[model samples]
Target: MTIVATSTSAFYERSRANMKDLRLKAESLQAQVGSGEKLSRSSDDPVAAARLRTLSRLEKLATIDTSNADRASADLSLADSAMSNMSTAIIRAQELATQAASTTLTDDQRAGIATELDEIQKDLLALANSRDSNGHALFGGESSGNAYEFDASGNATYIGTGNSQSLPIGDGQTMDSSMTGPQIFEFTDANGNTTDVMATIKALSEALKGGSTDPTGSANDALASLKSGLDTLSTAQTVVGTRLAWLDTVAERNTNLSELRANEKSDLGGVDMTEAIASLQETLTILQASQASFTKLAGLSLFNNLS
Candidate 1:
């Protein structure tokens, strides 16, 4: 009888271990389904676990790079639009100068065009002071407020700092936070004339209406100056386009890399549901058998056999 009890106790202990294992396996399957991961600990598969950790870190960095790309693209777009507007302003000034050049129009008509140019100048100044989504100057590099400081003499001066702040876009890649006010809207071209579009507009307006006669060569010179301003604006447009295209490539690469990282992470921790189910069923059967055998043996009596 003692032997029978000892054998039964051993069987019971074994059954208990098997049942615990089955419970653990079932829990693991449940976790895999719910959490969408195959392993919860390093003991599950150390190599895969390490790979998953690495991929997760890279994926997070890629996500941040994506955000930077979006912001940079927006800044470039704003600059491009502003440049286009400056070009339109210059074209209008050119037309006005041509009309005023005719010996036919009354001084009143010329003054009228000048008045319109003055309004256009105000509008152009407003554009030069345009802000980005973050409320920073779009053209003034990194200025927080208006980029142009128009003096009492109507001279528009750049009050912004030198370089814009930068955003980290990728591995060893960075984008200028924005173009500075001076870089985009302030400058002197190859000609002695200032290319400050707003300042030019103001000067032309004053020249037209300052009660001066068709100051013989002034209108022609103004047109030439306006053309120079357009050239500067056109060059800026080219730069913006190039930056935007480069950002597009960077954004595409970042997107592809991010997707690759996510895939790698899944591969590292993903489960095979078909295989897991098969293994779980097998473990359940073994545990059931072990429990049944342990129960039967625990009920056996050595006295019966002895008799």
Candidate 2:
């Protein structure tokens, strides 16, 4: 007769696995309470858990990009303020030009006005290469560490990168975080052009201080250029502001998406503490009952030899 085997060890092995599962669940719940997060491990559920991990990393990177954009936006705002000051200086220069145009004014009085305008031009140069939040050049483009320098001839030279630095915000969107000094203050000047608007203004100031009529023509040229420069700066400020606004919208959207992903991740990998605890308690009870039954069975024997 063929007999099938029934092993006492089989029941204990199954019971051991159940006990291990309960212990894991208990620890998982404790971890959730400690971390204030639902999913800490992908082993909870491989598919949904893996996606959550990706989203979490992406969210972190997106936050940093948003911050980068914000800082870039702030630098642009600072540049705009500097440009505003320059605009004021230009207006003052125009007024002085009108005053100097009067035949009644002496050369001495015109010289005083020119002296003040020269100071204004120098201030504008200082503002153009101002630092951003990172102590980097705001208008130095991609090379924030570099600053605009002046040579012995008082010519402005850019020690920065040729390209604008870009930061990725989200969803394949990027923002040009900064502009180089040349883009803002330098221009292609021909024979009559001075190559740099600041230098042109500075030269006009110096020429005017000589009490000579030579600057009258040059000053008119500078005045036109200053107006055009202001228009360009203002337009750039407007564009940067619009991009920041769009980034703000995108950040808001990403925030919502991150939250949703977190919740989905929890749904996928997070064990319900209430249900899990209940299951744990029941498993423990079952284990105790199973152990008692095993003990009782072990103490019994199908055949007792009575010789």
Candidate 3:
């Protein structure tokens, strides 16, 4: 039977290609074992690579969420402290009203108390216009300036937007970071009258200075208004405190989720050094055997044993 002609050049070419492929595979395993990563390119395992990419994206998002949570918590904490101080100021005003309402104090003494109350009013206004960590007005509600502004009449008017500031703390979760100035300082009393604490204190101060015919009655009214303001401040503090607690819960959940994602990423892309090393050893043995066979075959040329 006539044998089909097989070119020596073709044999050499095929053997070189096979040997190169085996060497590349062996090197790849070695790299995996050294670097502790499964693949250097997405082409090696597209599914795993895609999953890893998604995990990376989520990790970045979680970091951002955590920062937002921290900012919101801090802002709310400042708000609580400020409200607590406001409550204390109102309580002091209440005490002064009780003392001033007594018939024992002279007009001069009542005016002195009013002067101090005016100073407290100034303090309250400053507190209402307090700035946050970012230098924006804490109660401004998207406004960069003071939350409450004084008119030409020296009447305090809320210039801030009525909406409260809110922040995203996690997936599908958002929290109000601040309350409006009006909501904290201007609350309706049981008599259905809108009570402005600043104005009430100012009115009380003026009444004590003999602006009202019935100074004792005005003091009693002021005392009642101050009590309402205390309630408003306490409610605001409660709201802020509740939000802070929610943020803490969200923060914990985010941390746990981040850890879970990291573990999954490790499982998907991390290399098993022991398995890679064993595979590299097997690949090297196969390459060596193939090289020896090729070398022996290459030595047997058509002209080697020709007569």
Top TM-score prediction, candidate number: 1
- Please, what are the lDDT tens digits per residue for candidate 1 over residues 50-127? 888888888788878888889988987877888788778778888987776676777678789889988777777788
| Alpha-carbon RMSD to native, per candidate | 2.7, 4.6, 3.1
lDDT of 2 by residue, 1-307 (tens): 1121234455557766765675666666667655656667667667777787787787788778767767766766776676677567666766666665555666688678678877766776677678777777777776756557777977667788887777766677777776666666665444455365567667666767773466566566666666666555566667756766776787688678878877776776565767666665666676577667756755666412210
Off by over 4 Å in 2: 1-44, 144-147, 186-196, 214-221, 289-307
Candidate 3 lDDT trough over 10 residues, lowest sum: 1-10
Supply the global lDDT for candidate 1. Answer: 0.75
User: How high is each candidate's TM-score?
Assistant: 0.88, 0.75, 0.86
Of 2 and 3, the candidate ahead on TM-score is: 3
1-307 per-residue lDDT for model 3 (tens digits)? 1122345556778999999999999989988888888868999999999999999999998888898889888888888888888888989999999998887889999999999998888889989998877888898787889998778976778898878777777787888788888878887866898868998999999999989988888898888888888888888888888888888889889988998998898799988788888899999999999999998987866525431
Off by over 4 Å in 1: 1-6, 187-195, 210-216, 300-307
As for candidate 1, its clashing pairs are 140-180, 140-181, 141-179, 141-180, 141-181
User: Candidate 2 at 72: error in angstroms?
Assistant: 2.9
Ranking by lDDT: 3, 1, 2
Ranking by TM-score: 1, 3, 2
Each prediction's number of clashing residue pairs: 5, 0, 0
